[model samples]
Target: MSLKRSLNRALAATTGLQVRKAPRPSAPPPPPAAPVYHEPAAEDRLLRRPVFVISSIRSGSTLLRMMLDTHSRLRAPHELHISRLEVGYGSSVSEYAMQNLGLERGDLEHLLWDRVLHRELVRSGKDFIVEKTPGNVFCHERIRDSWPDARFLVLLRHPESIARSWHESDPAKRPYEKAVTDVLRHVEAVDRARETLDDACTVRYEDITADPGRELRRLCRFLGLDYEPGMVDYGRKGDPELKRGLGDWRANIRTGTVQPGRALPGSGEVHPALLPYCDSWGYTS
Candidate 1:
């Protein structure tokens, strides 16, 4: 999400409001359990079993990260675009092309990204590390390549809210198309990953803000951690270091509490073009 959009959300979200969504007649009871994780070999470094918080920008993934960071067993650090560095070799004439270079460049990228995660884990001395960067959702395979045991935590927010936040963040293009397209792409990316990985867990942004403890406790079990009381007190005990590193994305969480968030006002009707995404993802119109 853009800086302006981040600020707009910050200004508007003083307190969260539930939209009172209608009950899901077809929805199953107990919801779905997150993927079960088998213990890895003792030799496998805890750093290798990284956890990823994946979603599009402005979908509350950052807030989720901050909350998880407060956990004793977990550390949610700054964005490490590990996958972005793994530019697979392909035939192209562009300067960033990896085709001409042998496996050298790709190997280097893997090495650097791996080491970064390793260092972060070592510094925090935590059992696991969760990296949050919205764009990470698009590079599931790349992440898998580096750490076969890496786990994913996927988050979804209403497309209406996503599009509005995206457009508000960027002024150069000044239209909603790009925002809508990005949201759709992210939605598809997350769905594919859930289908492919047993270590993946999915959650909704609305659910998180609606009852943070419930959603987070579910996430905790998914990641195989015991829930700590006050895990949801992220708003009150925010991380200053994290806030500074986040740039404009820093505004709201700095409010020293998790402000109750609802669908953006007047966003009851999702845009027509974005309806396909809503239907597929279970977002009400």
Candidate 2:
């Protein structure tokens, strides 16, 4: 018999009907909690400062590196062969060595790769420091582990032309045969690495040579840099640091032949096995 009940009883008496309490309105559902969003901190957004290039020998990797070096934002180092040395073997090793290394190959590879990359990056001052090593194709994981935020530029060329060029060059003097085999092996390695890299790019040598401006623009876009026309003319500008051996193939090999043979000696035509890769990269048939 509280006041409210008394009032209700009074109301019931006056209205000739029983007074019943209204079921408590369901307490309005508690307001939904505000969504909390976490924005990445400044450190999180820093561009992964990789200055590394992985490409097969005779694949225009040198030219690509030189062109990239022309950019003020990048410093392309000469062929360091860091990965090759770390792997404890040269690319010229016979197939037997590959078998003998067996399970330990991966572990030894990881050790050598980690040491060289960490040392170089720790010592480098440039924002984008690149190691233009041909053997890196085989050591992408080691590179990726050391520099999780790193970027990779994989260069490719026609294997037939690569093999022919190697065969024609003095084997004893230049080790061209080994270079050819290495190029093929590295191509496959890069292809495998493509699957795991988050910020990786692939460029074809022919496409870069045929239309440097276009290719360079695309490359810059990939690297999140502003493209400059001067990158194409790096060689002509006499940049002393930029190596001159990039386009030597054009002068050294004859045109219209893919492989070395009696029919077409020294002619540097696109290799058939490599044609699909080149074509995929927008090379002319």
Residue-level lDDT tens digits of model 2 in 236-263: 4234433444333343222211222222
Q: TM-score of predicted model 1?
A: 0.71
lDDT of 1 by residue, 1-285 (tens): 977666667766865433344886885579544222232334433366788877777788777887898899898876766665543335445424432343345444666676788888889988788888877777776667657778888788877787787787775774777777766677677667667765678899888888889998999898889998677886554454554445235557766557687654354467776676676778766
* Cα error, candidate 1, residue 152 (Å): 1.0
**Each candidate structure's count of clashing pairs:** 5, 4
Q: What TM-score would every model get versus the actual structure? A: 0.71, 0.55
- Please list the residue runs of candidate 1 whose C-alpha ends up more than 4 Å from where it truly belongs after superposition: 1-46, 86-104, 171-173, 235-250, 264-268
lDDT of 2: 0.60
Top candidate (TM-score): 1
